[model samples]
Target chain A: MFLFFLSSGMFLGWSLGANDASNVFGTAVGSRMLRFRTAAILCCVFVILGSVISGAGATHTLGKLGAVNAVAGAFVVAFSAAMSVYLMTLARYPVSTSQAIVGAIIGWNLFSGSPTDSNALSKIIITWIVCPILSGIIAVISYKVVSVFILKRKIHMFRLDEMTRYGLVLMGAFGAFALGANNIANVVGVFLPVSPFGYIELFGDFCVSPAQQLFFLGSLAISVGVITYSKRVMDTVGSGIFKLSPVMALVAVWAHSVVLFLFASQRLEQLLLDLGLPTLPLVPVSSSQAIVGAVVGMGLLKGRHNIRWRTVGGIAGSWVTTPIFACLISFICLFILQNVFQQTVYLP
Target chain B: MAFISIFKNRTGIESEIDSFLNLASESGLIFMQGIDAYLLNNLDSFSEHLSHIVETEKEADTLRRSIEDLLYRKTLIPESRGDVLELIERMDALLGRFKGVMFRIEIERPNINSQFHTGLKSLSNCVIEAVESATLSLRSYFKDISQASDHIHKVAFWETEADKASTSLQKAIFNNNELGLDLKMQLRDLVRSIDKIADHAEDLADTLAIYVIKRSL
Candidate 1:
């Protein structure tokens, strides 16, 4: 029964992998700088590694927002978020799983009569707005530094192409790792409170925790999605959206990875705290938003005229509409599950 | 291991490109020598230089095709591959032009008066210098794009010098009442054909300038 209820989260994981993997490796593959097979294999390997090792940070923050204590409730929340993403995508609006999942969790909170943690909610909201801006700033600075460095070095043309190809592959790996660490929460965070897995003892001193087991399972679904469905998304995002040079593509991906890492890295947070500095809230930020932010930043650096305000406005509008759509869908679905099917969706 | 292969492939292609450009430059020198031998009435030496230029041009064409094949096969330098291939083809065409002039000189075997020998030699020198500058610009384009402009500008300067030389030589031919009109026309045609090589070089330089701008980071 627990496995049955967990299928929705796995489905959500598949969707996230299908969409977000493109964000990491699309430009490299699209520009013919790297092969699709190479990109996908590296993405799958590092995503699972990141999930097993570092996925907890953002999931903890998401659990704080609203911990749906029932497995059935978690299932409904995941399903609702997935539905909202599908609907928003069909509507030709930009959709983010992070925003949709957060809104669905809030709906679960309202239905269950649990108090929403205003602090966590506010932190997630603020990060949504800050994520893109921060990524854009990083991209501009990195591109300027890299371009100037290349100019000064005067590397031969073929040699420079070779170096850029290597750089793209390396950065794509990092971005995949970061994506898995940061966004695994959006895929399976709701199930954390009700995970059925128990800690398994490996060696006398080594053990795999229940959370790591759950994350590993979730990441496997993501890996399957990358293998089966990510190629088309990667191709379109890489070449069809806007043409990016291999170098600019590298900078954009690196910037996006860095921002995701900033939000998801507990070690970084602890390091900041140790230094008596403020830390960024560990949250699942949108990978698509980060990439868009990086591209926009490069456009701004090139010139203001290079940016298309109409497209920016459309994407911004979807950010607001997506959450609202998910929230309403969650409320309606939970009510039906409680009243018509006579299933318990809330502890109360 | 992949890293080692990448470096190896790059080094091989780099040396290939350098060798190809050297062949183009060598043909220019051989063209000048061919003209000098023809003026000095050394038919055997002229034939020797002509054979050497034909071999150089053939070698350049083969090298260029190999580079183009390797570039596509490896899918190296995707962004600038088209531009690079176009540049190689144009340079090769310039080399063939040098060979063509040598063949024309050999086939016509124009009767040259001693009066026009110095003028023809001067015109050949100017044409060779123009081609040399064009080849150097292409070399700079591959090695260091910033240095490309340094040599690109010189192609036009040499081309202008060649134009002046060709004009003065043509004037000298037409003014000589001792020569028949048919001979004068033949000499003028030869001067113009030589001058056309410099014109082609200048056009190539213009194309390189645009490619450089496109390649600018």
Candidate 2:
């Protein structure tokens, strides 16, 4: 039973590598800034590190959200999420693993009396809506500030260019680290409760369980995703929206990272809402939407004419539709898998 | 004594290679610049220099090939060996294409018209800037990779600028009533070939930038 859950998590990790790993280094590869091999190495190392260090928050959310207590339940959620992502990749449609997992979690929850906290669900949903829009807005504002500085200071063109390129490489590194830390939860968070040894007893009964170990395993899965499957998506993201200048690329990455940090932090979430702002809780949002919003925002700083509406619309449409599509597909798949193989415990 | 012998022999070979590459860079730059001059002036002296430039380019190509073979033989690191060879081949190819354009100019000199000259010049200028940027980048290999950012930016900026320039030049050629149909057709083909030199240079710059970044040069 332990082996079943562990193996399922590994399989899901491999699928995530195939899907989401590309999000970290796709733009650099696509923009012809980094090669496939270099990007792969960077993605693999940093993603694993991110997962080990900061992957806990999202993993905790996923573990509790679908009531993935049993090994079988975790396996079902993993399998459903993996299938949805694989289908999306095959179709060459860029869909979010975060969205697919949410759908899968909901699909499984439906059978277990849907004990899902509406507040948690709402927070995740709001992140889906708000992350991209906020990122886009931030991207535009940042670009505008940078552009104004560039123009106003009348900085030497060569120096500006040099600074921009270095800044871009740095920003990309930060974004990659953030991605590893945050998204690893989605891959390995489900197996936490079933981990054999509960939380370790540090002082008294204060113990760390198999949850952390599972998170590490998930992080390893993401590292594999970076190594094996990330190049294609990196190429797509790097060159898909616009031919990014180094400055513009830096701005987009920084905006995306800021939004990611917001969702990943509990402290920041309360601080923003306390200021009379309608705030979205930190939920695992789509990195793709965040990046696209940043790119569009940067474009808008150049004016409406410069913004590639077609590309923006296409990305937006994918974000809006992918969850519903994934949910329907998984829900139907659950029914089929259950009826087709009656002896098999399809849903726990 | 053996160490001294080795040092003397090594230094002799190194200095010889240095002089050879220096000559190659100078001649390559001159040839590139001459291509620009020929397009702008359409002068007989520039055309004659273009012929000489082609001959020097052939010598540079031969030197580049020999160095590539030497680097491949001596380097212990398999990856770096391959990278160096690829870099030489690509850079040599840039010169080879410049020679090809010179050859075309030699052949088409008698029939070359003003529109041909205008479009070809703009395209040639783009190639010159790209090659010049690449050569400058090569000189600073030991410096921080960020040091080469200017070259990368120049390559990117000039490629876009060249595209805009070529579009206008082509428009001018097509819109002009003075040229004969045969000359117009020939000039259109010439413009495209010249434009490709810039495209190739951009590709070379991108490849080198990746190499620099990866190697932390």
TM per model? 0.90, 0.58
DockQ for each numbered candidate = 0.68, 0.04
Please write out the lDDT profile of model 2 over residues B22-114, one tens digit for every residue: 654665566656665665665776777776767777777777766665544432122344665676677778777777776787777635565
List runs of model 2 lying over 4 Å from the truth: A56-60, A63-66, A151-165, A196-213, A273-280, A303-311, A332-348, B1-217
Question: What is the C-alpha lDDT profile of model 1 across B33-133, one tens digit per residue?
Answer: 88889888899999999999999988998899999998998888877899899999999999999899889889999999998888888888888888899
lDDT of 2 by residue, A1-348 (tens): 676657767866777777665555565565544557766776677767677666665453465466555456557677777777776665444567778777777876665555777878887787787888899898888877876676556543334434544555566666666776766666666566566755567688765456666766777776776677666555556666665655666677778878877777777778887897766565677877788777777666665786667766766676666666656655665566557744243334
Q: Tell me the tens digit of each residue's lDDT in model 1 across A242-314.
A: 5667888888888988998898788999999999999998877788778878877887887777566676676
Off by over 4 Å in 1: A53-61, A86-95, A189-213, A235-237, A264-282, A307-311
True contacts recovered per prediction: 0.61, 0.00
Maximum-lDDT candidate? 1
